[model samples]
Target: MLTVRFARLLLLAALAVLPTLSHALACKEGGRNGNVLITEDIGTTVAVPVTENTGVPIWHSSQRTVNVHCYKDNNVREAEEVYFYPNPRPKQGQPQGVQFGVVYKGQAYYQTERIPTGFSIPQCPSNVSLDKCPAVSFTLSFQVEIATKKPYPGNGQVGINQFEVLQFDGKYGINNAPNSNLVYKVTGLDKIRFIQCAVKVWLNPPNNTLD
Candidate 1:
């Protein structure tokens, strides 16, 4: 009886550890042997006020360049070009929202197919009444590109991305005293990053104002 119980416990322990081992192996299989070489910012920002009478959405855009370098052990190795768009444009049958893309060698490679898993908009101030306060919202558009081409002897590649604005600011009222010169500002982060890629770039403001 003692021998059987010991054997059963051993079996249960092995079963528990098996899943962890398998998961580690799976992560290794998907791991890349490449590192980011550099990232360049090349996108322009624009801010436009939304017409108070015509509540239209504004789209903000930006772009960047990323370089990837692959290596085997301590030495450089050749690897296939992998493309990614952190934010992508909407697809057919999808709602009209901002999307991002990745360009490779002057061509489109990857674009975001869905909305961002993490997104939020600020609520109107409590002091402002709903009737007097106009509703406000904005969208962010981005593009990333690969600057290097394939079949090259070098272990690195390069691409360029672009971001542009459809709109960034909105004017609620005509600078009237009752409205308190209400304006909506859509400001972007100074820097943005993508997973597994080492590229840092600056985002310029669209600087659109209405008084």
Candidate 2:
């Protein structure tokens, strides 16, 4: 009977201490297990201008997208270059310049496609009605897979398991003003499964210009 009671006390002590140790392990800066989730911009859209002074041509003044690509093998790299080429067409009314060549760079596995969402209106004079001449907007959706590998005890080796973002817009901004980075977390495992990522990008037009 005395042994039984002693064993029960020891078990309780272990349970209490185990949690404390686990908490400490969880607090470590870089543990074996990590997280996997794609980050998206918080804002809805960023406005870009389609002007001559601008470095390149773009589809719309503001645009956003989520892209993805499926690979047959895992030997691919995370920083692989993905290009998005817009459909070609002559500039409306102006029969002068070429109208295409807006490529967005992203991971190699992701495909090239713009997933448009909506439009925006630049600040114009009060006398000007924005309904007819409102600035255009495009939106895209991003998707990333969740990590499947259990957190090991060191820097985890994670791949772009599966990811994509929808792209919106055709024209590029001057100096590439409207741009941001994708947010990601190494929260857990190396292999990830169905995770969702959403972000929006837009541009601010040139100080005084239009397309």
Error of 1 at 129 (Å): 68
lDDT of 1 by residue, 1-211 (tens): 9999999999999988654332210000112322212223433332222111222223322343222211111111212111122321122122111223333334443332321212222333457553333232222223442222122212121121233211111111011112111111122312222223344355455465433
Best by lDDT: 1
Which segments of model 1 are wrong by more than 4 Å?
A: 1-45, 48-67, 72-81, 85-97, 113-211
Candidate 1 lDDT (Cα, whole model)?
0.26
Instruction: Quote the positional error of residue 11 for candidate 2 in Å.
Output: 79
Q: Which candidate achieves the best TM-score against the true structure?
A: 1
Alpha-carbon RMSD, each predicted model: 25.1, 25.6
